[model samples]
Target: MSVFDTACGQVRGSGPDRGVVAVLGIPYAEPPFGADRFRAPRPRSPWAGIRDCADFGPVPPQSAQLPGAPSWSPGDEDVLSLNVWTPAAADGAAPGGPLPVLVWIHGGAYTFGSGAQPDFDGAALARAGLVVVTLNYRLGFEGFGHVPADGADPCPPNRGLLDQIAALTWVRRNIAAFGGAPGNVTVAGQSSGAASVACLMAMDSARGLFRRAIAHSAVGPCYSPELAGHLMEKVAAEAAVPATSAGLAAASPQTLVKASDAVVDAYRQNPHSGRHHWDPVLYGPVADGVHLRADPLAVLAGGAASGIDLLVCHTTQEYWLLDAVGSSAKVTTEEHLNRFAADFGLPDSLTQGYRGLMPEAPVGDVHLALYGDLMFGEYSSRLADAHARAGGRTFLSRFARQRGGSEPVAYAWHCADVPFAFGNLGEESIRFLIGGAPTAADHHLSARMTAAWVGFAATGEPGWEPLGASGGPVRTWDAADTTRAPAPGHWSDSGTVRTLWRSFGYRPLRP
Candidate 1:
């Protein structure tokens, strides 16, 4: 049946093509606008009749016009909604009982992304025996910007995170009606979304909402309260607000987006600007000591998220995507490279070691490699290592799939593994991300990736060994050897690359 019952009303989805039905634009929380703007999410009011949920809800306010995804228009207020894609069940009940659920939070550096993106379609995942959910929450300044306290009005920090928790709560109470088991849920994301997963694991309010997590290329060094306040000051200055809760609320979302854009442009134009000049991302989860107890790695290593299975993965060259997209700054000479090292507080020895490793590479190439590892690769690896060391069951892997010759975006890089895992390589909008049309090997690789995700969500057996006391094997996804799973990825991270970053930790970045 295409119609299903929910807590507030009934919803009729649009499909059963190959056994999958998607109920889109279901409100998990009330609209976070008007009287509710900048506050924690509240329950949506009960409706009178069935809501026609045939399309995605209005997206959070963002400037990014992603491929095959709608950008936020000025007057869209009902932004806190979610979508579900379930296998067609027998009379509103799955034939083989409820399936494990996977809730996805899309990533665009915490500013712009939607669950309705073409790459995140859940039909393949539903066919793989999963009840898939994707959601939209507040973004940019509306979600992550810091606002001052205003007594009873309750302008809370990290409203985006609260929206996510509200969505999960809705799933817990209503997923069973859509052929999903409430207790068997996996929360997964990439980049900023992955970092949100790490944050959720440490939150007391999010406890018991899900049993597993998959973080791919989790970004790090969350904003400290002071840093968040500082960034908001810049945003307010540009928006002509007074940097107070009341003042911030007075400005419109579209205006704040333009202000935030101005701040990023200023950073881009100045080469001598601080750490943010390299990659001027202005919004992320704030470790305010109330919502987030501490950094996620610290919380996970301290055994906060007990009995949770964790799986982590990262692409070999994560920064290449940013460089190719012109989002990253250029460092062309040795002097510029040395200055880059000092700007992020990296030691000269690290650059020396990298030069020694890649003797023939130019300064620009070396900068990209080092920056990529510093921002994503090393952080993700360390998270997995820390979680495993704390006696948590963890699995780690690397995506080394790359295409040679002259495709600029051909590297096995950031965001490349998502389509493969979601089994949506054939989507027209996904061609640029995958470097033009797909190959037979790419399709085969996508199946293998989806199978791995399915296996992990089902039984916690991801076809490889769990991390042992010291280290564990990593499953490699490569196009070169789709014929057979290559040699088990050994605990090779503890060697040269990791040694250089051994003393490093996630500190609040400065501008």
Candidate 2:
């Protein structure tokens, strides 16, 4: 056991397994419940004595039950805590100066996830000579559901985002005590968490908190206040309450969670429910024009994220995970494919272009390809390009590592790259995502991926040339060929998919 002082007080942590001390479950803010419910995070009241924090804290109000991670039952209030993994105080390590810090935000849409998720364990990164921090924020309706303002202290919108910001503020103030450089910090996440990183780049309060960012599979981020309001109404309807702050707040977290899930089921069952039918995820950071100035794409293109060094990554087949897990809508016939295209306002020419690209592919495959790009791939690429064009230091990479060319195949789909990047390929729970046990080649790829992350967090360089709107190297991580990164030459806009989305405008997902 080891002890370290934080702004709150001293904490005892377990570690030095191989030179890393992890201080888990330290409160970064007061729990957002009771008087603080549906509100911005309150600063944590300092503690007086040594707090034993050997295990992870309680998660937020979420319904997700990730394998090998704790699940949320009702009344788990202290969800705004964070964990630190560092070698600064580990056994058998010489004393060193402050190390670069990498703060992680977990991705489970905007509804349910915690820093305790298995893939986010920070020990590997800590071993690579960087202090790693992961945190939990409010999820589901409690964190993101819309509410009416009360007098001068209008309950803030994007309260989940606010919780994340509060955590980062805590890191800025207290990370140095964990042997981290307060001035040097990088924020990283995947899926919705990646979107949060993008939002943080464009946010005023989040400025100066992170000097660099790493976003993998950054899904769309932008929910208009009207859309947010409507979802709240639906949730209220499910809970049998009035669609007001008081009514929703009066309900229990368990009730709200069940209500929100019912609303999601309603959307999932009704094909005409618009975009939410395809993706029933109900909460997101509201672009209320105050906290988040605009949609992430527009904000980044307008240059708000220019000063931050950015690293973007996305898998080649992002939507397959959703399809495999029976989470996404499947389009099989030509009529449904056409309707799917029209649903998102995709151009006929673009659909035809994709057909030309993959003529033999079934309607479902075509739909997945187009839908994945619309939701993740194309959007993520544009973010990188926009940041680069606006004068930000940016790098882009694509994960294409797969299993056997023959038997027992696993596509380089969403989340498959995470465990590899984190170097936890041997874990049993994660093996299902990465397609069974890893091989020597997979281990090599994991090392390279981990090294790239270590290098970028340490120095803002990920072993590839800085990307630009016109041209730059794209580091390709592949197990098939571990000898070289990015293999041969690849273009900045090489694929037909890029040209198809050249002038497309992104809109908020609707119900």
Q: Identify the candidate with maximal lDDT.
A: 1
lDDT of 1 by residue, 461-499 (tens): 677777765776777788743222224322123256767
Show where candidate 2 strays beyond 4 Å. Answer: 88-96, 150-152, 406-408, 480-494, 509-511
Q: Which residue pairs clash in candidate 1?
A: none
Which run of 10 residues does model 2 get worst, by summed lDDT?
483-492
Which whole-number lDDT from 0 to 100 does residue 308 have in model 1?
88
Each prediction's whole-model lDDT (CA): 0.86, 0.85
Q: Tell me the TM-score of each prediction against the true structure.
A: 0.96, 0.96
Q: Report the lDDT of model 1 for residue 290.
A: 87
Per-residue lDDT value at 81 in model 1: 92
The root-mean-square deviation over C-alpha atoms between each candidate and the true structure, in angstroms, is 2.3, 2.4
User: Candidate 2, residues 139-210: lDDT per residue as tens digits?
Assistant: 889888888774535788888889999999999998887788888899999999999999999899898999
